[model samples]
Target: MEKKIVISDEQLQFLSKYLNKKFPNLSPQVKIELMDHLICGFEVKGGDDFYQYLSNEENFIKGFINNEVKNVKKTYGKQTWRQFFSFFTSRELLPITILTLFIIFLISKSISNKNAWLIFVVSTHLIMIVSAIFGMINKKPLRKLDEVKYLGAEIWLPFLMVTLADNLGFKNWLIQNEFIFTGYWFFTFIYGVSAYIVLRRQKKIILTKYKALLN
Candidate 1:
């Protein structure tokens, strides 16, 4: 039998750091797997020399990272949707809706009736800005993979609100009628909750990956 391919402690540390830099865009969970893949490839394919094996055309780590990326996309996609939808029934969503309704109701009662449209528009900006701020604080390093879901999703509410606001007559209509206001309230409520969920999820992603990168 061939001698065992045991990696030294120093070699393992070096490999871990290399993998972290090589796949900075990958989430830590996947990055950990990539590190293992690289090491295993080096051990199995080496002809007595680790450096030679890594430099050879047959290095398997690249293949491993590609396959792992597919799995990561599928796994993260499902979890992302679940986390997003969970906000619908969450307690935080209720208080926000009630508060929005109360505030908008007050604005409708006291605003220069001509500018009631500003209520939803202003609220939309506030939610999106808050989400962006949270994202800024919980920033993740740039990765090779696509990762704009959190902040990207957060902007849709503001975009929609701006478009709705363009039709000044309809916005006034939404503000003036209790029935129409209910629809507007529901829309803003859903968006606010969704934006909150996305921002929180982004924070979790940054935290999870940051720990992995350190190791």
Candidate 2:
């Protein structure tokens, strides 16, 4: 025999709000079907009275929202990883590479001390390589792969400037003189821009994913 289930006004309101957000145009039959399924599931899960079940249901809804928030955060974290690798392979990594080469050239030109340059270059390269690898392995990708492509383009500017400076010998120019600390400012600007872009992208992706889950 199919058992009947009862729901409270509060539970009905909560479910209605949730469903309306997901399906603003949802048909009456569809809403009824959803409510029926939910009520049946709630009854099976062990609430004997409508009020008791509604209480439990409220808690369940709260927990569900909490979990969804966490998942959204996780999704954003993955997108960040994607951005990191994309940035690394695209342009941000180039400045470091150029800087290393410039350091080697200076060392060779000045003291004929290949060892010092070798150590600096190798250590820096290894550190960067290892960090990239670790980030790739440990970082999660945005839950929705399609959203990854929409990441804002503005984040690339700082990287572009840094690369340009390094390539045009401006970075070396700054390094040779103690008063030319403007390069560091530019670098800091790049970091700040990258962080802002990543965070903004994360927020957008998370909200989109959460809204999609309602349907």
Top model number, lDDT? 1
Query: Which lDDT tens digits does candidate 1 get at residues 1-215?
Result: 77867778888886667666665565556667766776776677656666565556334667766776565555544554555556556686557656766776777667665576665566777777776676544333433343432234444655576676465647656666855665565566555656566557765666565655435
Off by over 4 Å in 1: 20-30, 44-46, 55-116, 138-185, 201-215
- Model 2, residue 27: C-alpha shift (Å): 21
Clashing pairs in 2: 78-140
Give candidate 2's TM-score.
Answer: 0.36
Per-residue lDDT over 31-76 for candidate 2, one digit per residue giving the tens place of the 0 to 100 score:
5665676677776775555556555565554454455445545665
